[model samples]
Target: MSLSKIKAPLALAALSLVMLTGCGKSSSQTSKKQEFSWSTSAEISTIDMSKASDTVSFDQLRNTMEGLYRTGKNGKLMPGLATSSTVSKDGKTYTFTLRKSRWSDGSKVTAKDFVYSWRRTVNPKTASEYAYLFEGIKNATAITAGKKPLSSLGVKAVGDYKLVVTLDRRIPYFKSLMAFALFFPQSEKAVKKYGSKYGTASKYMLYNGPFVQKGWTGSNLSWKMVKNKYYWDKKNVKIQQIDWSVQKTPSTAYNLYQSNKLDALSLDSSQTKQLSKKAGFQLINNGGTAYLQYNLQNDENLANVNIRRAISMAIDRSGLCSTLGGNNQPAKTFTSKGVMYVGNSEYTSGIAKSSEAYNKYRKSEAKKLFEKGLAELGKSSITVSIMADDTDSGKKTVEALQSELTQTLGKIKVETTTVPFKTRMARREEGKFDIMVSTWIADFNDAISFLDLLTSNNSRNYGKWSNSEYDKLIAASKTTSSSSDRVKDLQQAEAILLKDEGITPIYYISTAYLIRPEIKNVYNDNLGGWQFKYASVK
Candidate 1:
């Protein structure tokens, strides 16, 4: 399975938001097209589902590996290895019928493949960043916590073609979550055969998805994906090959596009302004939220809501939007707008009113809050470190924030630290900084994908921010059968989070890309990742 499915939810969530906004970046074409080359700003992290976390690896994996279900041509959930699934009356049990399929090496894909894959991921030793996504599965939490054995994970392969999964509760987004790469089955034989070195290179992994990575060194800036003959639906896989290059510089990618060496190009803030007037210029709403997380574990002051609110209020979100480019918008809530819809209204728009003050630039109020917070802390001055990605855009963004905060908030000395994406992620996971600049693409399309991070016990809650009332509201939304009522509960949860300044919302992402007219069926998912499964180059 393409590991990028981990991040696919972020891009996939855009499908709902984009359709509502009518800002889709693609148009369809029927002409047969073939052999396309692409570029990425970041490098792949890993193909191993147990370890893959970043968007690049997820994007690569989404195409190279097959999941139980795959996002189809129209962004609809479509069956892949599973012929179909049946849901029980209560919606807590799912029985999947596996299709007759073979791995790239010709071994039949059995139900045990899924059983083994899920067990391996939730096993304490595997240390999967995505293990948290398995919370709804019965015994999944216990297995990951090392309290239960793998066999207790509540998933059973009834027979070669039948698999039954019992979840602890109803998950409205369970189907979409299953379609993600993290839920895809790994060939047990292939995994154990490669063992420690599995997923480290293209050669070590087996393929059942539409394509398989070819010539991938596991850390190369260049590689290829060729149509996998072993794919059960390979006949409909019109595009036989995809070429890839990792280019962080937009100008370099633009030059490559001009030279016909690249089929698509992503524009930077500068490029967006320069090329947006021309045809094929797309500014896609990715339904992604970028924000700042305070590491309450790093400092006592970080735990103070007053300090967080002051810092959040000092942000000039409108300025940040223009500076960041790509048609980014100042975010009004932690959850990306359009992530959920209730009665033709957006989930973000329907949230409870709070003194949380979303995106209002109030330097005086921020200064007052900072002063009050300092008094409460009984401190004269506090030094804070800002950890951010080392990408050009990331650097610029952090610098912009640092400048804004330093200029507005008194006595708050700022130290800026920049590192590669992986290193930064490690730091975030370890809770090693005072504040961190981060963006989350939806793990699955829902407000919870964003709000869930604020829960005190969530593994991804690096900040250590917690509130019981907020947790209860979110916890209730999970089991609520009424969609409208659930939305109301989620709205209150988001309001409580913002009112407490649990996180500083910055902006929602918009994917800006330059596409050649010949590239067809190119769709960007809600989470800010691209789907190239149905893409073709004429």
Candidate 2:
């Protein structure tokens, strides 16, 4: 699923933000450390893997749950609950050999756990937002659409420790997708015991990963990740506990970091400039894009191609990046760089070079288009409002866009409303805004993660933009067996989306942070979420 709806601030690290103090120490000394204090800008929404659609919740889930596979350093697939797997010659079937593991409650983790979780997620009654990710699995789409029984969904257990999964077609990133939180195993007994209360709080959920979450109420901003003694790989887990807190304001977070209360802090634009020379300052280029999603179904002006193009072209992306500071760069396409490649060359490079007219700042052309659009709509002026998060960076982003649109598109009035992250997401889901400021952090290392969001039938397609040709190309990309043909289809679809200004590309996000020197072995999954399983205090 897409990470979150708010700006990148809510898109903080995927795992716990590790922090520590002290000089280099021996492995033995590090192994004895008790706890590490960490901080994030957003609170956990829900830990239910099936229902989670945001980064913060998924990050926490990654800490406390284990799937068939775990994403290790550099996006490599590591053994989790499954120890090995064999694929059929036709590439439509997979059989996995499981490991002997136990959940925090001391119940054996078996293949039945995976079967139960997969069925629950795809069941129409469950209403999982991420059920669409299972589209390629056999009967998954039909099951999610309520056209098939849950038992027909192609996953089953063989005995106690073997799992068999059948797919309708080959998914190129199938193994990587298995590492995502949505694929984590869920205990039927726990779900039955808690029923509606399942995953609502730490006490109601079962954990099989390196840590067990505690102290998190449904709405609290503080929690703890205590090491799980029942984890199969417990011997390799070093840290005893992780203290997690939320600090939305950059200044407050930075203050805590300075006072040794926090081990890391995500910097704001101004703080990034002021702390570039600090010893532990680092810029994290998360494969994420922040853009503008127009409500095409609800707003008449935004539905017009000319008006959407006008709003897109009027803004100076480079200037906006400068105003916001940090290392953010103007986005040339919806997909960020370093995600996928079309034969050794980055996929987005060719598309960006070809989209100069649409991406470049052209105030005069934008003004002409805006006037023409207004004339065609039989209106002298139009009023529009942008919805964004109430955080400092979110406010700056909308304010800058408002200035550019009103200045370049004369007779157009642009208003801005900034709400808390959760409220803004609710409004966008309800289709209650003219323009919504949105951000997406890829769930995996693939361009499809971003491009799939604009498809006409996508649940995440908040704008409701429709293009038959674009949808066809996207569908073709998935079915074609040839790698080159798939690339061509995706490229053409992205080109169409850009030419029509379906969504205005803003900038690629690069967050800055300060980490103490004593933290070691921490690594980010290729998608940019950090993993603390192997982390140690040194």
The 0-to-1 C-alpha lDDT of every candidate, in the order given, reads: 0.73, 0.77
Where is the poorest 10-residue window by lDDT in model 2?
Answer: 14-23
Model 2: lDDT of residue 512: 73
Q: Candidate 2: lDDT of 9?
A: 19
lDDT of 2 by residue, 40-73 (tens): 5555678888887776777778888999888787
What TM-score does each of the candidates earn?
A: 0.91, 0.93
- lDDT for predicted candidate 1 compared with the true structure: 0.73
| Tens-digit per-residue lDDT, 62-117, candidate 1 | 78887788765324577788888899999989999998888889889889989999
Q: Give the clashing pairs for model 2.
A: 19-263
Per-candidate total of colliding backbone pairs: 19, 1
Q: Which candidate is the best by lDDT?
A: 2
